[model samples]
Target: MTSTESSSRPYGAFPVRIGFQVQPQHAEYGQIRRAVAAAEEAGVDIVFNWDHFYPLSGEPEGLHFECWTMLGAWAEATERVEIGALVSCNSYRNPELLADMARTVDHISNGRLILGIGSGWFEKDYQEYGYEFGTAGGRLDILAEALPRIEQRLSKLNPQPTRNIPVLIGGGGEKKTLKLVAKHATIWHGFGDAETVAHKHAVLDQHCADVGRDPGEIERSVAVSDSPEKVGQGLLDVGTRLFTVSASGPDYDLGLLREWISWRDEQNK
Candidate 1:
């Protein structure tokens, strides 16, 4: 798909979504709360925490926290911003159980939850938690098999989700991953530069076509660096309406988040 393929000029107004991945690895719970509060106040569209036991970067043994517990707290603390893991590891919990947990949190947030998920990748998370650290292909196979089951479980669950819980899937592998996104995801969290993202999006479009799903139905999201001006317009032009910036803990940087939020408002207006 070309950059213009996702433009609002053809689809009316596409609201820009600004997401902040509040890294829980190094920051204190209080600092996280304050940062979330600040982002909420700044008018961020989404507030995300990563699902990891250890720090992904910097000091590996640095301060860290669990994913769901923090999300539960965030559900109570934040008033407006949608909350979820940037991408939950599907291997950590059973698909049915994960659906229920997501449903419960959805209600807790008053229907403000995004079930961001991905095939498990971090080997340490699995080994330390007593989960078998399978090969990458095996894990992706698991994810592909589990996603439909998760959707079915969501339907069968009593009371149901407070809203149609948006399922955000991260990863850019073209063959299986993009096909899975075409089949299951409400949002596709892609990585890489604009050209790379665009190419993957084209592949996803083809996958959607093959599956008889509308390509535009899946929102394209990306993890951008601190510099918005450098790549913002290019990404937007390529159907990436949702942009997330990741910040690690100890010193939760709200500065970059504010700028992105402002940019979102400007673009939308």
Candidate 2:
């Protein structure tokens, strides 16, 4: 790997890995469960569901399942593949309580959990759940405060996390979000094309430097929309190693996932 690729990650290199986000909406739980199983068998490095009370696309009132509860079941269902939300809304649960939930799930998965969290943006979720729908800056502030609390609680939990329980903070806010990523995240998930993500990577590297952290300590993750052949190399040429592709129910097709997995295998070789 070149300096351009590992500039932020200096300790060791991260192999190209694929992640699948199984959106739990407009489908039965049975179908959702099956999708996760198939993704693991198909060879994804991670499995994720979004943290929301409703559908993010299509019908606004479509059938949906809660995030953490489904994760509890996934922990028991899959023997491989790390599991968590693409980004759990930090405002939806008390940070300490969220930490315990993550710990319990970590134990259930025998340590295959990734706590992906963010400052949240869905207004309907807050209104329906009766959480304070505050300003974007306010929400980010709340997320900033909550991360430390979650880490502290995780340290005090009974058995402690099986591992440090990798924290994946999702967002591209150059200011607050990247700074938090520099300070705490084991993985930083963001959206955008190669150029955009490269800019974010540089900003994050500066943040890492300012905080006296090794830039390479954090893995860069990005979401993919096109075929691997179309979007993969551009991202890899930069620093992104964990490429996530999202699938929505009812079918939750594994074709896209398989393509990405195959591409990952080729890249790693």
Candidate 3:
């Protein structure tokens, strides 16, 4: 590998991996469970479900499942791929409690867990559940405070996490979010085209420098739903090694995921 190639490996020696987020909305629980099975059987590296009380898109009054409980079920059902919420809102559960939930799932999955978390959004979820729908900045502040407490609680939990339980922080905020990524995240989930991703990555690098962290220590990840041949290469050139493709339910299609998985294998070879 060239010097640039060596530095771009997100998890040191690990190769590029693909993830599928099965949106648990507008579908039966059985359909969602089958989707999880299909995703892992199709070779997806990580399988995620969003953390929300209701559907994010389509019908407002559609069926949706709670995030953590579904994850608990995934732990027992799937045998290979890691599982977690795509981005669990910090405001919904106490940070300490969330940490314990993650730990328990990690044990259940025999260490195949990634704690993907972010500041709360979606005002409807807050209003309906009676959670304070604070300003964006305020929620980010709470997340900033909560991250450490979660880590601290993880340390004190009985038996501890099975493998340090990698932290995947999702968001593209150039200020607080990226800074948090620099300080704590093992993986950073982001969105945008290649130019936008490169710019955000540059900003993330600056944060890492400011905090005296080696920028290469953080893995770059991006979400994509189409045209991996066009965008995936651009992202890889700029250091993104994890490509997460989102799939909604009713028919959580694995066609795109299979394409990305094939694409990942071709690139790694």
Candidate 4:
């Protein structure tokens, strides 16, 4: 690993940040709304929801809500923490329309929006929604094409975003996905343990160089489980700074969020 790509990816210097993904499945909208409030109160740096038409766990056809609309509500409901989908699948909405929605939510939240997007999976969502469930490679190609257009639309919006609304691209495909992250994303989110993330980081850095981007410019995020001690330390040591945990709704429990918040404070201190 090159020096820039190896151990120096804004990990130690960038203060650790915690996120809570309020999974919008199997719950009342009120329950999801309240959880966002509680997460912000508990000192999470960001609040997120996943983009799916139905429940990812528990009941397959469980009650669920739309992603962008819920984000608009969260923008109005929460005051401090940033809000967005854990990743809004690119295949679901037109790129330009998605950009405008993100811009609107950015204003609603006074610039607290992170446009987390990905080359969507979840065949059921595509199948039922009447979208062509093409090959993964084709989907990724579509995402690659959409990203630049999203940026263009964001620039041309009526009132413009409150800030240059941060773009977060979620995926770990070393070739295409990381390249997109280098080209557009302010944040890059991936799944895995410390070892897996470490390898991804190294690959991402190479992509950054290939694209002539500074490797440290993008924030590294990971979806996590258990305590900061069990899963966080290894990730942190390997250069991940933004750690996100998910809460399944109905009654959104924030106990783990509290623990992660405490750990974040300790690390930042």
Candidate 5:
């Protein structure tokens, strides 16, 4: 492993950040609104929702909402915490249009937007919604092509984004995904156990080296379980600074979010 992957890096230098993904499913819209408020109140750094038409779990017919529209509402409703999809599917809309939507949301939130996006999976969404469900590699190829267009569109917007509006790419495909991340992402959202994270980080670092970018230029984010005492420290040691715990409706239990917030406070101190 590179020194960049070593544990000797100052813990203080790697300040811990936490995010909450309030899965927009299995509850009324009001319940989701309340959950977002509660998560912000609990002191998360960012709030996220997934982009899909149907419920990812439980009843396929359960209550669900579209991703970008909810994001617009979230931009209006919240004041502090950054808002975005955990990942919007790159295949759903034209890249330029997605860029405009993100720019508008960035304005609405007064600069608190993280454009988390992915190549897309879940074939049912594509089929039911009249999209082409192609091979995974084909979808990734589409994402690779669209990312630059999105950036170009962002550059051309009339009322530019409040800030650059950080781009967060979510996926674990070591070849194309990590390469795109090395090239385009401000943040890379990944998942796995500590060993998995370490291996992927090394792969990502190699991708960065191949592209002549410092791997450290990109922040490492991971979706972690609620119990920080059990698994959080391992991930942190592997260079993951941003930890996200997901909460689903209807009750949207925030007990884990609270624990992570407390853990973040302790670690940062």
Candidate 6:
């Protein structure tokens, strides 16, 4: 569907979603499990892992793990918080198949699944997997083609999602990426400073206008400074309902997470 078409209804309550990208490329399975448990007990809104074969930071050859497999385990492990990869690579798997996998996870989580995705990046993941690491434009083009197929497959799946599986797209490319967000995403996770985020939010609004969709219908999300007391009110003022902070191994620091969760509580109060 085009961006102008208002695809979904207005989002419910200003949800203070705190997402953690528990980097799997450098931690043991037991350590990762413990971190997930900690985040859930601390009351984080969503738990995320990245889709990569090697560590994105520190030593590239350090302990690493796969994405979807861990997600399956996470679906069974965490009872309260929503779970998914921070952004699954669209090129990694066939779209229809990916939809079915997401559906399976949805049931596993008892309806608490967020299908976060993005056009594939990371050259190492491509080369090692024996998949062609095409040009950036080419990858985005592939994503453009794949999203619709994935959505269509969701409808045809037998059991269907227990709850409407929230589709989250992460990227900040103005031209095509923002346009895709305007068309499909229930939540848009972006990166950058407040100024950059504000500009992109405006651009997204224009895309909404171009597509005839209400810009407010799409929830704005971002990865912010770990200290919420410093940026919380400011970010809240700018229409960002979801705030994510990324943490990698070998030590998964939850200090900032705790602060943000407290801030979230204060905001609600």
User: Please, what is the TM-score per model?
Assistant: 0.95, 0.96, 0.95, 0.96, 0.96, 0.94
| Model 4 lowest lDDT segment of ten | 1-10
CA RMSD of each candidate after superposition: 1.8, 1.7, 2.1, 2.2, 2.0, 4.6
- Compose the digit string of candidate 2's lDDT tens values, residues 1-269: 45465544552388888999999999999999999999999889999999999999999999999999999999999998999999999998999999999999999999999999999999999999899998999999999999999999999999888998999999999999999999999999999998899899889999999999988889899999899888888888788989999999898988888999999999878
lDDT of 6 by residue, 178-199 (tens): 9999998888999876667778
lDDT of 1: 0.87
The sequence of per-residue lDDT tens digits that candidate 4 reaches over residues 146-211 is 998999998899999989888899999988898899999889999999889999988988888888
Quantify how close model 5 is to the true structure by its C-alpha RMSD in Å.
2.0
For model 2, the superposed segments whose C-alpha errors exceed 4 Å read: 1-12
Clash pairs, model 1 backbone: 1-202, 3-237, 26-250, 27-250
Best by lDDT: 2
- Per-residue lDDT of candidate 1, residues 1-269 (tens digit): 34455554321145789999989877778988888898888888899998889999999888898999888888999899999998899999999999999998998999999999999789888888899887888889999989998999999988889889999999998998999999998889989888898898889989998999887788888998857787888888877788998888788888887788888888888
Rank candidates, lDDT, best first. 2, 5, 3, 4, 1, 6
Q: Please, what are the lDDT tens digits per residue for candidate 5 over residues 1-269?
A: 34355556432255789999999999999999999998898789999999999999999989999999999999999999999999999999999999999999999999999999999999889999999989999999999999999999999999888898899999999989999999999889999998998888889889988999888778889998749999888888888899999978898999989999999999888
**lDDT of candidate 3 over 1-269, digit per residue (tens):** 34376455444344689999999999999999999999999899999999898898999989998999999999999999999888999999999999999999999999999999999899999999999997999999999999999999999999888898999999999999999999999889999887788788889989998999987778788999776877777777777889999888799888888999999999888
Q: Of models 4 and 5, which has the larger lDDT?
A: 5
Which should have the higher lDDT, number 2 or number 5?
A: 2
- In model 4, what is the error at residue 253, expressed in angstroms? 1.7
TM-score-superior candidate, 5 or 6: 5
Clashing pairs in 6: 3-211, 4-211, 4-212, 25-64
Per model, state how many residue pairs clash.
4, 4, 0, 0, 0, 4
